[model samples]
Target: MKARILFVCLGNICRSPMAEAVMRHQVEQAGLNDRIEIDSAGTGDWHLGHPPHEGTRKLLDEHQISYQGMKARLVAESDFETFDYIVCMDTKNLRDVRELLKNAGTLESRAKVFTFMELLPDKGIADVPDPYYDGNFPFVYELVNSGCRELLKRVQADLKLA
Candidate 1:
């Protein structure tokens, strides 16, 4: 079965979407695209239906990473049941997701929700900050790039990928 991953952020226009695209790229390059699914969402509905932020699009463009077909959407309760991992961009997002799960009464779901930075080697780095406000897309991109790489490595080992 394909392992599903869902990236979550406050608006889904910056951090989460960037992580989704970067992680997808890493999975595809590793030839594990068929074994893994990538997706993203937001905790709030403010940006629902909106495309990723211009900053995110531009940064991904520079890296030749495609964020096409990505649109902001609020996280549904089903996400906790559907995705293998529901990774958040920051502490607020993580707390929001946990609350959502609690509200859904499925807090014991199979999906694991945590910060995207949790996969990073440095335990001190706790978040992939939202770049929508300060336009710090480059910094977010660098962090997501490494985080996704490490996430891929973890998935590779977990799935016994060749």
Candidate 2:
């Protein structure tokens, strides 16, 4: 079976979706798209059914990354078991993921939950700041793009595809 990844943030209309696009791009470039799956979700329902934020779209467009048909959706307990890794944007998304897992009686999630910045061990950054509020979409994309590169490295190693 293919390994699955899920990127998560508070609203899914910004950071998470961007990360998804970035990571998917890398995976495709590696010719692993058929062996891996990527998706994204929000910790809450604030932007459910909405397309990614304009700021996010702009940054992605600048890079020619496609986020076609992506819609914001809330994270669910099922996701804990569906994805191999649940990559969150910040601490809050991690907390929300934990809460969801616990509520489902799965105290420890089957999926490995990691903060996106955790992949950038040497970058000294700890969170993928929300561009939705700060309007620093470029900065967020920079971080996510960097992390996604490292994340793809780790995934390839984990899947013994290196």
The TM-score values for the models, in the order shown, are 0.95, 0.97
Q: lDDT (0-100) at residue 124 of candidate 2?
A: 85
Evaluated with lDDT, which candidate comes out highest? 2
Number of the predicted model whose TM-score against the real structure is largest: 2
Q: What is candidate 1's local distance difference test score?
A: 0.87
Per residue, candidate 1 scores C-alpha lDDT tens digits across 1-162 of 678999999988889999999999988888887899999999988989999999999999998999889999999999988998888998889999999999998668788777888887475777776777777889889899988888887777777774
In model 2, which residue pairs have backbone atoms overlapping below 3 Å?
none
* lDDT (10s digit) by residue, model 2, range 1-162: 688999999989999999999888899889999988999999888889999999989989999999999999999878988999999899888888888888999688668898988888787878888877789998888898888888888888889988
TM-score of 1: 0.95
Off by over 4 Å in 2: none
